[model samples]
Target: MVKYLIRRILVSIPTLIAISIVIFTILALAPGDPMGEFALNSGITAEVRENIRRSLGLDQPTHIRYIKWVTAFISGDMGYSFTSRLEVSSLIFQRLPVTLWIVGFAYLLGALLAVPLGVISALKRNSAFDMVLTTLVFFGFSLPTFFTSLLLIIIFSVQLKWLPFIYNDTLQLTDFNSFIELIKQSIMPIFVLGLWQTAVLMRFVRSEILENIHKDYVRTAYAKGLPNYIVIIRHVLRNALIPVVTLLALDIPSIFTGALVTEKVFRIPGIGALLIDSINSRDTPVVMSITFIYGILIVIFNLIADILYGLLDPRVSSTK
Candidate 1:
């Protein structure tokens, strides 16, 4: 297992390099210039602009700039953001925890709800409860995230007054004093993400459970006088969870990028919102840094999934 993990980490180096190359190439070719924002702002002359350009190494050839950026990135210096005039790494570090809180809570809550709901629906197949859940799942899957967030805000925040309408605090990374308030602010966004993820996860769980329940192993368990609950829990749910694990492993990283629309709608500060702002401002350092971080996360999460797959199912060995 250790050897496999090491090998996976090794493989990720080239994979990330390739991803960075592609991201850098695409962004470099994009229509906007990072210096353009400075040009538009008042009291900035051509000399000032040229000085700014020189400081950013933007006056150099594109290839030279990319090479310098790549080298700096490899050394863990992600460069300075042109718009914010802050270190890219520092900015990401400040916002990462907020995103983790939302993503982590949503993932756990979504999976917990999805598993039980799926099991109940599958066990009581064709019942009213099952029908209702299925219908709701369809709607949940169909609705866009931004629209869903809006509806949730309107119903829960505006009409019901259960939670705040917006989360606009200056979140500090080092402070734990505002933890309670942070959690309260996160509830709506977490629910919005959770509800959507639950719909998809439930469908996967329901399908896998229904298929496994009919297998010979399940029948043999029943024939051996095992209780229905035991058969379902030990035999059914165990095997049914493997695919859900894969889906979860892939889906979690998406929250980092996928929450852009939801964050915008809720006025929540997160990595997704940062990504959009970086893109709009054409802040190459911020954009490249975030992309690199994302690529690293994907590689790490996928490796974790593979390792978990081997652990969960002994039939899938590390050697294989």
Candidate 2:
């Protein structure tokens, strides 16, 4: 296992480098000046603009700029955002917690609800409860996240006045009251994101469980006088979880991607919103850094999934 892990890490280094190069090249070729915001300022002369460009090293060749950016990034400096004039790394770190809180909690809540609902649906098969759940799952799955977010805001925030329309980033989670406030603000966004994930996962869980339940091993377990619960939970669920684990592991990257839409709708100040703002402002450094970080996360999570596969099913060998 250790050897396999080492090999994967070593392989990922070059893979990450290639990914960074492609991302950098694409961003560099994109049509926008990082200093375009200053172009309309009549107070800033052409010479002053040139000087600013020189100071930022933007006057250098594209390859040279790329090399400098890569070197700075390797040394723990993520460069500065042109618009905000803040260190890119610092900006990301500040907003990362909010994104994590929403995405992480939503995914966990979705999984908790999805697994049980899926199990019950499969156990009951074509019952009325199963039909109702299926209808709701399909409805949630088919709707766009932004639409759901807006609908939720309208219903809960505008009409019902039960929850806040927008998330309050200022709400600190130190004490109980602050924590409760955080939950209140988070409820809408979390529900929107969690509902979609639950719908998707519940279908998978139901299908996998149903398939496993019909397998010979489950039948043999039942034939050996094992209780139905024991047969399903021990013999069936353990095996059924293998594919679900893979799905969940890969979905980690989607936490950021999905948050992009959700954050925009809810007005949450998170990495997703920052990415959108940076892109619109043509802040290349911030965009590149965020994109690279996302790529790294995806790669890391894929490795984790492979490791988990070995753990979940001993028949699956990591060494291979």
Candidate 3:
């Protein structure tokens, strides 16, 4: 297992490098000059703006600028955002935890709720329970995250007054003070994210369970006079969960994608919101830094998924 994990980690280095290069190149080629925007905003004279550009190394050729950016990145200096005038690294670090909390809670809650619901749906296939769950899953899957968030806010916050309408700050880490606050404010976003995750998980889990019930091992277990619940939980659910586990590993990292909508809607100070703001403000350094970070995260998650696959099914290691 250690050897396989090490091999996978080693292989991810080149993949991450490729991803970084592609991302950097695309951003570099994108239209809009960071210096031009700054100059325009400051109402600086052309001569002063030209001098500012020169001092900032913006006058350099694209290749030279990219080289400088990459070198700074390697040295743990992501440069400064043109708009915010703050270090890109600091900004990202500041906002990262909010997104993490939102995504993490959503993933955990969705998995916990979906798995049992899916199992029950499969167990009661063709019954009212199954029909209700199926309809719910369809509704959850069909609703977009923003719309779901709005509906939840209206019903739960505005009409019912059960929870707050939006998440403006990250939860505090001490004594769960911030956690409670986050849970209250983040309910709508979490619910939206959770609903989609639950819908997808339910469908997959039901499918996997249905497929595994026909397996020879499951038949053997049933033939041995095991209780139906025990046969299902121990003999069937264990083997059936491999695919769900794989999806879970992949889903963890993907939670950040498109989370800007939720963050903006909720007024949360998350990395997703920051990224969107940086792009709109033409902060090249921030955009590049966030892209690089996101790329690294994706590569790391992919490797993690591969390792989890091996762990969940030892046969995968031998095959690899």
Candidate 4:
């Protein structure tokens, strides 16, 4: 297992490098100069603009700039934001926690709800409860996150005045009252993100369990006078969760991406919103660094998924 993990890490180095090159090249070729905004200022002369570009190394060839950026990135420097003039790493550190708090809570909550809902649905099969849940699952799946977010805001925030419409970034949880306020602001965003993920996960869980329940091992366990719960839990659920493990592990990347939309809707200041803002402003360094971070996350999560696959199913060898 250690050898396999080492191999995967070693392999990921080249993959990440290639991904960095592609991301850099694409951003380089993208329309909009970093100096365009500066040029728009009436007080800034062309010579001054040129000097600013030179200082930032934006005057260099694309390859040269890419090389310099990559070198800086390797040495624990993420470069400064073109617009904010803040260190890219510092900006990310500030916002990353907010995104993690929202997305992480949603993910765990969705998983917790999904397992039981899926088990009940599978057990009941075509019963009325199962049918109703199935319909609601489809409804949640069909609705776009932004739409759902708005609807939630309207119903909960605007109409009922039960929750805050937008998240408060400055709200610190130093007291119980502050914590309660944070929860109130977070509820809609968490629900919006979790609903779709739960719908998807529940369907997978139901399908996998239903397929496993008919297998020979389940039947044999039942024939041996095991209770229905014991047969289902011991003989069926373990195998059924193998694929679900893969699904959940691989779905981490999507959580971050989806948080982009949810954050925008709720006006949360997070990495996703930062990325979008950077792209619009043509802040190449911020955009490039964030994109690279995303690529790294995807690779890391995929490795985790592979490791989890081995752990969940001993028949699947990790060293292989």
Q: How would you encode candidate 1's per-residue C-alpha lDDT over 41-104 as one tens digit per residue?
A: 7889989999988987878887898888889887999998888899988888777777777766
Cα-based TM-score, every candidate? 0.88, 0.93, 0.88, 0.93
lDDT, candidate 2, 1-320, per-residue tens: 77767777788899999998999999989998988889999999999999989999988898998899899998999998898889998998898888888988899899999999999999999999999999999999999999999998899899999999877887766889898888899999998989999999999999999999888988889889999898888878888888998788878886764388999999999889989989999998899999998898888987888778777786665446
lDDT of 2 at 87: 95
Clashes of each: 0, 0, 2, 0
The regions of model 4 sitting more than 4 angstroms off are 254-258
What lDDT score is found at residue 267 in candidate 2?
90
Error of 2 at 98 (Å): 1.5
Instruction: Kindly list the per-residue Cα lDDT of model 3 for residues 6-79, writing each as its tens digit.
Output: 88889988987787778778877888877767565656788888887888788888778878888889899999
Please state every model's RMSD to the true fold in angstroms.
2.9, 2.0, 2.9, 2.0
Q: Estimate the lDDT of model 3.
A: 0.81
lDDT leader: 2
lDDT for model 4: 0.88
lDDT, model 4, position 3: 76
Stretches off by above 4 angstroms in model 3 are 41-43, 157-163, 170-183, 255-258
